[model samples]
Target: MAQTGSTYTKCRQVGTTSYNKHMFLNSECMSAIDCAIMCKEVATCTAFTYDDLTKTCRLYQKIETINCELNKENGGITFTKETECHVNWETCGNSCYFYEGTTRRTLDEAIEYCISQGGYLAEVTDEEELDLVNSMIKGSVLLGCTLYDGYWQGRTSGQKLVFNDTMWAPNEPRGQGHKCIQIWKDHGKFDDISCLGIGDIICEKVSILRFHFIVTKASDL
Candidate 1:
């Protein structure tokens, strides 16, 4: 069993049966990590299996404990389970967010830092997500959405953004050239400001499970 926000040790082999609700064939999964991300996206998914031979990934609602088979070629299958995020990160709505206030980084610097850490600026699209992000802010922080080409857009998806009006503070987005968005910790609302402005940084990426390979003897098959 895996504990949320803790390391997981046990792994399992897939049985002959397959769960069809969430399947990632070769075209969808380039690696086991990709498969894990797919599993993480589904709130109901509890485990996943990546087949090294067919390059297939499948999701399950529970761990498999019977009818296990081992491939002749070193098993060639890796099983993984959902686990808690790493330190300093919060997992919600199928995404992982990292908030840091110790050092302030400019918008560009924040983007660079997030890229270096394998994520991008946080993008809060809905009120639920916005509220979750708001709860994490100790102070203002740069978000992924920015004013681009006369419209607010999410950098990751490049789609037009339409957040709830209540998310913004009174008379907010006050001036021109204040394109980047920030979450004001005091009010838990948003404010538009210059991209060059500095503040705490929030990085976001798809939720992921820690990697753990299962070992099963041939006799167990």
Candidate 2:
């Protein structure tokens, strides 16, 4: 399977069946990487693409994204199971992760990790919980590491934004540069923070949107 830009530990080598729980438990293909296994709380598990030519399994990361004909629950596809998270986050696919890669990256790198997973920054939808999310960070150990020192200037990786469709709050960066806006309850005033400021982050599947239906890189058949 093609690695997601960065090397990870013991991910499934091949097959649509991921999450090590019941490896290949619900598969039909006899000589190929068949079936995809989703966990109990997994809301989205899209169709997996496993190429015999390349021997790579590309898992679609989305909530209710994968649409496979439900065989018997016993006919589930099990892949390499890593730590499945069930924190206070929404269900994307069969998993809900706050941080994509826990390698202590800056805001931009972390955003890349999320997009690579077919998502964006864990944008908070409400103000009340958004405030709590900010207050909750004062004493807790942060998730990502900072690449810059002083300012929260993390829109450097260049993601041209169009927030006119979004609720661009006052004092929020409307121009660009420090364009990657974040949320916080600074002094109970909901304000837009920069992505550079280290804080807990999360990513939930927005919708079942597949970017490409072809494999970019994989082993030859």
Candidate 3:
């Protein structure tokens, strides 16, 4: 079944004309779909409004109004966060990362598991992001970048894995038999190892919401 309020509606009257205190950022978007995608990618965006006339996409950290209202003059629509990061997934930057510490799996198995959960293996983009992942993980975890042909490529982005000396451990990326990458907990640096070895899984997904409501437990009730 289709989700309610997923489609855009025409604006009959002027709602909130000026940018309110709730708005965090605004950008240019071609369509409502593009606006929605932008909102999803932002970690702090809980709601958004897109102006058809000006091609303006406004992202809000919180929605002040009960309903997502549209701008009458611009003939635009608004959208609120309808979904959130999956349970046990941590929101970081533009993606939701799930760190599985206890269970260990091979590189192939880890990739399959993340794919089954509508995500891909975790890809550390920068030093700052790597530090955040290092703080969350208890032990060594498998990463998304793998040795493809000759260069390292990300499974999710299909892009070359770019890194500096600071991103890697001392004498790492052991070329020959080592085909997979892992984040060493002790040093918090990238390490290349054989794909057959077992390691903790870290999964990454993009579609996430800012606010996550707590689910009450039946046992507590």
TM-scores vs. true structure, each candidate: 0.59, 0.28, 0.64
Which predicted model would earn the best TM-score? 3
Q: Number of clashing pairs, model 3?
A: 0
Candidate 1 residues lying further than 4 Å off, grouped into runs, are: 1-83, 209-221
Report lDDT per candidate. Answer: 0.69, 0.36, 0.69
TM-score pick, better of 2 and 3: 3
Ten contiguous residues with the weakest lDDT in model 3: 1-10
Model 1 agreement with the true structure over 170-205: per-residue lDDT tens digits? 888786778889998877889998888899988887
Deviation from native of the Cα of residue 122 in model 1, angstroms: 0.6
- C-alpha-based local distance difference test score of model 3: 0.69
By TM-score, the candidates rank as 3, 1, 2
